[model samples]
Target: MKKIIVSILLIFFIVGCGLKQTIKDTAQDLTNNTVALIDDAIDEITHESESWQATLQELSDNLTDEAQSTIRNEVQNLATRTIAAAGSEIRCNVDFLGARVVQALQRIKAELLNKPIPQRNPAICQVIPTAIDMNLTPNRRNKVDISGYDFDNQPLKLYLITNDNQRTDVTHAINRLSHYHLVLNLGSNGVLLNETSSRLVLEYKDSQMSSIAITQPVTPDCKEEEISFSPDIITYMPTHTRGDRDYGGHGPAITARVNIYVDNNTIKAKIYMRARETKSDWSTADGSGVFTIYTAPSKRRILTIVSDKETSTNYIDSGHAEDFFEKGSGELVKRFAFVGDTDGDEAGTRTRVKVTFNRVVVKLKEIGNCKE
Candidate 1:
């Protein structure tokens, strides 16, 4: 029994010692594992802080860049405006400074926006061609005159003078005239004309002459008369009576009044007859012809006489003068003429004549007169 007890105690002691060693080993392993886990957590926190700091730096840099870009762009726009205002009068070192400042601002702004700055080109803002003003007048007959002045207020060119019959091409006229003026700035600041740029005037001498002297004289006629004597010797005698017989035969005089119109594309005039006349007395007037005088409407001024004949005549007369600007209507005065019996003659032997005037100026608010 003693032996058995001793053996049991030994076994107990050995087992306890083994268990303490096992427990100590397990405690050391657990402590090492905990330290390792704590080290990993600290490293993770440090790395995360570094990443946040880097991100913040990047965001600040971007913000600064954006602000700088905005400022630069604003400066560049201001400079551009200033340079534009300087116009052609800008001179000296101040202009250079202004240009440089503008360039620098634009460059900075472009850099921030990752774009290339465009270089300034002299041709971009060059004043090419120039400006011109033209005035026109009438000549011996009411004529269309073209004249021009340059930007320096100097006379530039006389492009063309033409009559637009509303049938002929106006493009040809414009092309012919364009040779005289330089096309510049899309023609906005060039080629100006006055309201009376084109005009027609009429002048006449002895307009009120009632009759014209005939170059050839009429033949005189004598009638034979039978004479009877009351005395015993009665003789039949031929009495010769010599006198100029009335061979007055006047044909209807035809006249035409013309009106000239100048517009963007269409140039036209209205024509009307003054009166209709019928020939009478075939013995005096060989043929009975209806004479018509086509007069222009009052709205259109008489530009020129298309024809003037004993049978038909057109007289371009500046019988009256009026201004468009003065009237505030921007229209011109047109004249016309008509013929009728002035003195009422029972035999329709006399004719009367008069003129009717009108206004024919185009409004300036129209567009697209010429197109290709």
Candidate 2:
């Protein structure tokens, strides 16, 4: 009975130890499984978040490109509309005033072409009358008698009448009257007439037509090298007998004038002869003329002469006048020139006589301080 009890106790101890080992193994297995499952779940969530962030970035880029394109198109449309409106305004303004200006210019051109060349004679000096009044009321016969005096204060006559009570008629008369070539200007509600030649000038003011007289003088304001603002001067030269006898005999004397006011200051003065009442021609000696320009203070003279044939000469006598100024200084002095033609080749066929009588204005420099 003692051996049986000891064997039973040993078996009980062995069974208890086996049971504890099994429980420990089972608990370790469960913990390992739980840790693996949590790691897998975290990986899946990270991948999904990355995909969502990439999609959102792509959508933002597309929206930015579309918005920029729309803004560019809208700006272009606004600019096009603004330019179109500006062009329309300019076109409309031009269309409204273009016709009237054109008509006025045409009328002036026609009147200038129709004007008569005055006959040059001592007794038959041309006369221009001024100070005529016009009545604006339609169909009313209001006539203004225009009269004036010649340069010698001789009585002159001119008729002033309105035709058909039309504005065009008045404009036509004004155009015709201004073509007379006389200087008729207004000063303090009165007319100032510069009548020193045969050319008559008529002026129109307040719808009234007036006239100014021009005459030739025996002796004019003469200066050897005087600066003049008139741009013209007249002189007389005696004719000579030379060359072949078969050629027509020249006149006893040649009366001529120099017109310096030609197309601004770019052109030189034109030299013309008045042999008879209506005869005039270029100098036979061609371009054998001298122009001496002088500046003030220094009074230095710059001499320019045309020594070639008229046709071959590059200098045109119809442009801006020359200027005289101090070097490096904007100072203007009274400027003047001596213009004349000299005779070359004594044979009458190509007689070279001195030709002088043209003049022009001189340009001056502005005043300024000297640079140190």
- Candidate 2 structure quality by residue, lDDT tens digits, 1-372: 765664454345436654223223333444344223323332433445323223223322332322122222323433342233224222223222222222322332222233332321112112223232212231221222222111122222222222322111222222112111222222222222222222223332232233332222233332224233332222223233332212122221333333332232233544433221111332222222323232332322223222221211111222122212121211111122212221222222322223322233344322222211
**Cα deviation in Å at residue 340, candidate 1?**
4.0
Worst 10 residues of 1 by lDDT: 229-238
Best by lDDT: 1
Leading candidate by TM-score: 2
Q: Write the per-residue lDDT of candidate 1 for residues 149-178, one digit (tens) a residue.
A: 111222222222123311211111221122
Off by over 4 Å in 2: 1-257, 261-288, 296-363, 367-372
- Report the C-alpha displacement of residue 246, candidate 1, in angstroms: 10
lDDT of 2 at 235: 26
The estimated TM-scores of all candidates read 0.15, 0.15
Overall lDDT per candidate, in order of appearance: 0.28, 0.27
Off by over 4 Å in 1: 1-270, 274-353, 361-372
Backbone clash count for every predicted candidate, in the order shown = 16, 29
